[model samples]
Target chain A: MKTVLIFEPLDFSAKVIATLTEHGFEVSLNKDNISIREALEKYSLIYMRLGVKIDAKLLDECNSIKCRFILIPATGIDHVDEQACYKHQIQIISFKNKKELLKDIRATAELTMALTLTLLRNIIPAIESTKSGIWNRDLFRGRDIFGKKVGIIGYGRLGSIVSNYFHTFGAIVQVYEKNAVELPSHFERASSINDIFLNNEIITLHVDYQESNIQLINSSNLMLATKQPVFINTSRGQLVNEADLLVALENKVIGGAAIDVVNEELGFNPKNPLVAYANHHSNLIITPHIGGCTIDSSHKTEEIITNELLDLIKNEV
Target chain B: MKTVLIFEPLDFSAKVIATLTEHGFEVSLNKDNISIREALEKYSLIYMRLGVKIDAKLLDECNSIKCRFILIPATGIDHVDEQACYKHQIQIISFKNKKELLKDIRATAELTMALTLTLLRNIIPAIESTKSGIWNRDLFRGRDIFGKKVGIIGYGRLGSIVSNYFHTFGAIVQVYEKNAVELPSHFERASSINDIFLNNEIITLHVDYQESNIQLINSSNLMLATKQPVFINTSRGQLVNEADLLVALENKVIGGAAIDVVNEELGFNPKNPLVAYANHHSNLIITPHIGGCTIDSSHKTEEIITNELLDLIKNEV
Candidate 1:
């Protein structure tokens, strides 16, 4: 049996572990904070999470090792060194490549809606005040999402799902996607990004992160906003300029913001501008990149990855 | 011109006030904390809000005075003294009788959905922790509302609207309404309240407050919640027994609860068990009764009530 190195606390279900064991893999769950070098020499297969960054230096360490396959139990491959893996003759397997595993992307879209609703309704202050033994409902008189104009930055699976939700809630949804696709009858297509910012009362970003897309929502683009809109970003953090967002919030350029991902999310940096701004402002809601982190989505992803790994092992044998 | 006494800060829009003034009513906007006796004797018409209790004593005072009509600028007339109004020949006019005015009941329904989503996603704690500069995404792994069984206690206007929202989110909506009306094709009718409690992952109350409906969600009925569902209430606070709800939270009989209304909401009672419990427990989220308090809803209701009041004045002339 091939020895498989499992990273501790990766949110993989017991069923996933059992499936690997049943498939005749000697799964050694590692708890010690040892270097990637030690694990590469001992095991031919490594199972890790997205939080464990596999950079170029770590990939270089796998040059003279028994390790051949690196499996990530997430949809994002941003943390992993793809070029280094190819150079080292090592194969990278992630849920990102498996389209079937990504069927439950609604979890991310739902979180976007939840955060958006929380911002619009002033729910955080309302709850905080109630907890402090205050019954001042008048202070929390919020604006209704009904008949509000919502601008979506992407029209992919997740963006379309979110657009449908807002539309169902009586929000007029407008999309500013690069690709022209057949949208639902209710959703209007924005002519440009400026059209989305100028007209929409609420704007949410769901575009994929790329090198060119870095800091896409900078100060100049944010200044295009005409209506005091509540901004939401459940997508990649690098897509937004954190400093510009903070400035917009301080100047009241935007009505509010709900950010699930931040630029410095990998580490808990207390001095992160978005984090510091959110600490002081009740209107800015920050969640630590848990948009896709739902029990159902996690379990489904685990099942797909586990099955895919078993198939890969069989093909290799 | 009939002298109409306006209550201070009743969320009535400026347009509503202008409509009354234009219609030849001498609108006296009062600010001093004067007695109902002064209001009855000085003014022919009294305009009040939901917070002001118009009991038998106030009605008796109107009997000896020029006051002819008691106008409430809201849907619920539970606070007004109906029998005393009849004896004193004081006409009780409210937005409750105006169907056109109630078109924007979506605000309350939207609040209900917001609270429900907040509970399911553990958003309160997520925000609290994030504000404290913590970026622990694993701690906020929420469950998806999709494919979850949601039990709605009423099938009236607000309840049906909420039901549609949950159903659109891919939740199986089972409703328990006393009167069987034509329901949407997607909704499943629960034979009894017990069915709702026994087989649902989420439960929300939308019943009107009445004599027989007091403490509708008592300990016994709450204990029947086999799924440990997240309970939500944006309706009348008197409909729930706060002590029973607190017990449910402490015992983990239910998954969690998000309450916008409580039985003792008329005043801020720090000793209220629900408030006290929420202070310590993150699972329980409390918002002080702001269900129908959206800016859009308030303005729309005000417009409708103002038009209705004008029609009434024209009829009297």
Candidate 2:
């Protein structure tokens, strides 16, 4: 029987170990502290999460052994050393390859809507105040999202989903995607980025993090906003200049902000100016990067990976 | 010119006050401290909110004077002495009479959605943790509302609207309305209230507060909730017994709760069990009675009242 090794605890309805065992593979679970040399010697197939860095040293150890495949139960493979894996002739299988698997990637979009509604209604402060034994209803007089103009900065999967959500809630949706495609009839396309900023009362970014996209919402673009819009960034923290965002929030150039991702997220120091501002200002809501971390989404991803691994093993046999 | 006494400081756009003034009415704005007797003697028309109670004594004072109309810029007239108003032959005009006026009452429905999303995502604790310098993403793994079964307790204006919102977000909506009307094509009408509690993962109450409906969600009905649903009450708090709710939450009979209104809200003591529990438990979210207090909703209501009052004056002339 082929030995399969799982590197982390997975929470899914499907019994992965039992399924692999029934398929004639001996499965072993390992803690993070397990030696790479020992793991490679025992298991030919490996499953791990994206947070487990598959660096060159680990790749070298795997290449010297019978390791044939590395199954990642995630969309991103940035943590893995791709060149080393290719050189070692180890096949990489990820959720990204299974186009049909991510049909319902609504978790991120749901979270974006959650954050948007939280900011719109002053829910965080309201909940905080309520918990603190104060029932100050007057202090939390909110604005309705209905009839508000919402600008979606990207027209990708998540952005389109979020746009649909806002539109369903009676907000007029405007879109600005550089790689233009046919849009739904209800969504009005903005001619330029400035058009979105100038026309909309709420703006949310869902663009991919690229070198050119860094600091996309700087002082110049923010200044063009005719309406002091509540801004949301669930895409990437680098997409907006943190300093500029803080200044805009402080100066009341923008109505408010909800930031899920931040630049240097792993090294997010409490002393950061944005973090400091978020601590004090009720207008700003800072959530740790958890847009796509819902239990449903994670379970779906795990199921897809498990099915794919079973099929791969069957084909190999 | 007929005198009009505005009872409170209204923050509506300049248009509402301007339109009222243009209609040949002498308008005088007064603080809440203004004497009712003094105001009735000076003005023929009066504008005030529901908070400014018009009891029998105040009604008698108005009856002895030239006050012709009591214009309440609200939906409810429970604050006014209806018998006295009728005895004095004074017309009581409210937003309810003007059907076209409240074509879109979106604020309460919007707040309901906000509270629902906040609870599902554990946003309160997430924000609190982030602000307290703890970046714990693992602690805040949420569940998607998409594809969840949601039970709506009432199918009236607000309940219907909230049902539509949940349906749009991909939740299967089950409704239980006592005044059983023909439901929309999409919603599944539950055979009984217990059916709603038994099957759905989420339950929201939008029922009117009445004598018989008090303690609707007591221990008996709460035990019927097999799904351990998150309960939301944006309606009057007296509908659910506070002690029962706290017990259910503590015993995990319900997954969570987001309460906007509470019994004895005017005399909300911090020592209340529900309030005390909310302060300790992240599962419970409490908001002051600000469900319909959005700036947009207030402005819309004000505009509708102002227009109706103007038409009433014109008709009288």
Candidate 3:
């Protein structure tokens, strides 16, 4: 049988599994963390998520293996070393270029809004207060997003969606895109990143992960937060300097923050300053990287990727 | 000097206080829970919020008092006995008739959407998990609001705002308004309240409180929730039957619920079953009545009502 290895446990529907089996494929799911390189040697196709990092060394070790395709059912392929995949001639299939498939995938954007509201409204501690048998609304009065100045770092797929959401809620949205992208009529284009931080009350990051843009939000830009904006990041953990974020929260340079990604998220350390700060502070809310961890998005993406993969395999045979 | 008593503690700006004092008004803020009837006997104008329950008995006892006007810095007149006010010829000054002023008060609506996303995204527990040094995303996979059926009860001010918000998030919105109200072209009007519960994946209440509509969401209508919708109530505590709601949550008749209001919110008893259930289970999320508690809303409403009361007093003098 044609061998397939799902390197990460994902919610694949029964129908998708049945279809793959009928097509002469033996599907094996990785229940426990195992060596991906060894599995790649035995399996011709490997289905993976963000859990495993496909670095240059791993791809080099599996270069001579039967692994021909690395199937990633997500938009960002930053987890996979694209340069190394090209060197090994292994095909990396992802939803990065598939705009049609990703148009309906709003999990990440939804979480961005969720984090913003949760942070702004003090929903976390408020819920905790109510759960602890206290009902003091005075203690947890929240900031209004309505008529507030919200700054968007990147006007890409997720950014645009979030900008629209904030705008609908009566917020004045300002965009700061590095590469020139057409903005909606209502959105104000920030002159510079510093201007964005200086003017807005809420700042969110949604930039695609790139080496050039690493540590994009640091002390330099964060220092210009004159309005003390609530910083939100749902993109990648490497995008912001967590150390600088800790300083900003401590000094009240920014109002607060809600983050879904951490720098060392794969094997997240509790020792991270931001995580530790979030444990005690009401300003910082840290969710377990659940931006795209929705059942609806998972099922749809899995089914679509599976069908597409089957078609490609059929064509090759 | 004209006497005025602020019966409830509110965030009145320094400018407002200056303005009141400059206009020959002797303002006294109630520092303790003194009897309103005694205060009424001394002060001609009394400012209040929802903390005090104004009934016919209290109004009758204070009927012969010098108090001629009740200044409520809120929209809801349900807390005050409107009939008694009319019977005693005491004018009620509130935001109920100020559509122009209320157009910008989006705090409650924002909170409604906040609660919905918080519940649907499993944000509270996810944050707690991350705080406790757990990074398991699988444990908190959320449901998407996108492409889900959302049923909105009441298409009034707050209800319509929430409907528009849900629709913007890609939800198919179905509104159930008891009285005839014009809905947007995109929104579907439900045949009955029962039909709304049966069809939608998420249900939110925004209806006004009325004696006729007490316990509107009981076991009778909750039984029809075939989709097991997440119940959201930001409207009023009295609109839902607490006993029936507890039973629905326990039986899984409804998916989960996030409520900002409880029936016994005034001096709230934490012994309530919903509060007790929320302490243990992740399904029920209870927030203190923070729906209208926003800095922006509070400031704007206070200023508006204070100024309006001053204008009335000026005209009467």
Per-residue lDDT tens digits of candidate 2, residues A1-317? 78888765545334666777887888777756476555655678887763456667886655366777788866646567778777877778886545457768677788888888899888887877877878767778889889999999999777888898898789999999999588999999998788988999999998876568988988888877778999998887888888888888888888899988777665567777887888788889988877877888777776678788778767877
Clashing pairs in 3: none
Q: List the residue pairs that clash in candidate 2.
A: none
How is the predicted docking of candidate 1 categorized under the CAPRI scheme?
medium
Residues B274-296, candidate 3: write the lDDT tens digits.
99999888989999989989888
Question: How far in Å is the alpha carbon of B127 misplaced in model 2?
Answer: 1.1
* lDDT of candidate 1 over B105-161, digit per residue (tens): 578888888888787778888887887888887888888988899999998778888
- Per-model CA lDDT versus the true structure: 0.81, 0.80, 0.87
Q: Which ten residues in a row have the lowest lDDT in candidate 2 chain A?
A: A7-16
Which has the greatest lDDT?
Answer: 3
Estimate, for each residue in A117-220, the C-alpha lDDT of model 1 and write its tens digit: 89888999998888888888778889888989999998877888888888888888999998868887778999887789889999999887778788999888
List ranges where model 1 is wrong by over 4 Å: A5-11, A28-41, A62-64, A97-101, A314-317, B8-11, B28-41, B61-66, B97-101
Q: Is the docking of candidate 3 incorrect, acceptable, medium or high quality?
A: medium
Positional deviation of A273 in candidate 2, in angstroms?
1.7
Fnat: each model in turn? 0.72, 0.67, 0.81
Q: Report the poorest 10 consecutive residues by lDDT, candidate 1 chain A.
A: A96-105
- Locate the minimum summed-lDDT window of 10 residues in model 3 chain B: B8-17
